[model samples]
Target: MPLLKVVYLSNNTKLYLWKITEDFDMLFSQVKLKDSSLARLESMKSESHQKGFLAVRMLLQHNDYSDFDLFYDEFGKPHLKPQGCSIKDVEISISHSNDFSAIAISDSKVGLDFERLKEKTLRIAPRYMDVSHLKNLSEQEKIKKATVVWGIKESIFKIKNEEGISFLNHIFEEDFSFEDKKATAKLIFNNKEEKFQIQFDSVEDYIFVCAFEDVK
Candidate 1:
C-alpha cells in the first residue's frame, strides 16, 4: 500500500513532505530504509518511528536516492545529498499516527515533530507558554491551541537540538491563532536570531507538524 499525499513545502528551501496511508509491511518494500534502524525499530516501542518510516519512504519515492543507501549521522540525524554538489543536502523528519504518517524534507536545515496532542497539553502548557500567550487564549482554548504552542516549541527544539527549553522561556509564537493552520515562531541562538514557520495540519485524525529554516 502507498501513501495518498505528498506535500512540497519549499521551492527555494528544498523541503518536501509525504503522508502515508500504507501499512508497515507494504511500506518497507517501497523504499530503502538503510541499516539496522529498520530492524532495531522492531525491538523498540515507538509507534512514531514505525509510522515515520512509512511517511519518509513516501518522500523517497520521488527522489533518485534509495532507502537502503541513505544513512544518518553520528547523532542519528539523517544525512542527505546536497543539491548541485553531486549530493542532495536534504534533511528530514517524519511522524505517524494510526491513519497517517507525515514526512518533511529540506535543502536547508529542518526539523519536525508529531504527538497525539491531548492529555499531555496541560502538563507542558505552562512550561513553555508565556503569560501573553496564555492571556490570549479563550477559556475554551485549552487543548488545541495549547498543543499548537507545544508543537511550535518542539519544532524549534528540533532545529536547536537542545533539551529542557521552556515554552515560557526560550521561544514563543509571533502571531499564532489556533483557528489558522499556520504559526511562526522565533528562536534565539547566541546573538543570532532565527524564525520558524509552522503549519499544523491533519490527515484524517492525525496531526502533522512541520518546521524549517534557510541558512547561509
Candidate 2:
C-alpha cells in the first residue's frame, strides 16, 4: 500500500494520493469490489487504467468506504452512497495519471484532477489557457504552471458536470504566482457565473489540483 500522502484540505474535506507500486494481480487480490466495478475494471482496455481503477478503490477503503459505497450518476459523476453513521451527502472526485491515483472527499461540492507534467502540456497550453500566464517564467516553471492551470479547468469541469462546458472558452483561472500554491477560477457558461477555489500541489513529477465551489 503505497499511500503516498494524506492532505487535510479542510475540516470536511481531505485528499488522498496513492503511488501505484503494485502489480495488477496484487491489487485485484487485496481490495474488494462490487460486481459493477469488477465488470467495469474488465472493460478497461489498458493495464495501467485497470490499475488506476483498483488504486482508487484502495484509497476508498483507506477512508473506510468501498466500491459498494460508490456509484456513478447519469452524468458519470462519482457519488458515495450515504451511510446512517455519517453525513447525508458526501461528494467525491477522482483522478489518475501514469503513476498516481488521487481522490478527494468533501462535504461540499468538489472536483479534482491529476496530471503528469510533460512538454505536451506546455506546447498545448495556448489551446486551453491564457498564454499570458506563462510569460516571464523559465521553461520548467512554465510547464508546472500550465499543467496546474489545465488541471484547474478539469477540476472545475468535474464539479460542474454540465454539458457544453469548454475548457478554453468557459473556465478562467485568475492570475496567481506558483508560490501561492492556490488560486481561484470562474466558470462562465449558459449566461451564469460561478466561482471556485483551487488548491494545487506537486507529487513527485505529477500535479494534483482540487476545486471547491465557493460558498455564497
Which candidate number maximizes lDDT? 2
TM-score for candidate 2:
0.97
lDDT, candidate 1, residue 40? 65
Put down candidate 2 lDDT per residue, 1-216, tens digits, no spaces: 678999998999999999999999999998999898899999999999999999999999998899999989899999998877876768999999987899999889999999999999999988999999999999999999999999999999999989899999999999989889899999999999999999998888988899999987
TM-score of each: 0.74, 0.97
Instruction: Give per-residue CA lDDT, model 1, range 1-216, as digits (tens).
Output: 344666665673433445555666766666656558668667758665676765566666666556654567766666665546455556766555454555566656777666565656755676678536656555546666676677777777777766455557667687566668787888775556777778776544445567766343
Judged by whole-model lDDT over C-alpha atoms, candidate 1 comes out at 0.63
Candidate 2 Cα misplacement greater than 4 A, ranges = none
lDDT of 1 at 58: 63
User: Each prediction's Cα lDDT score?
Assistant: 0.63, 0.93
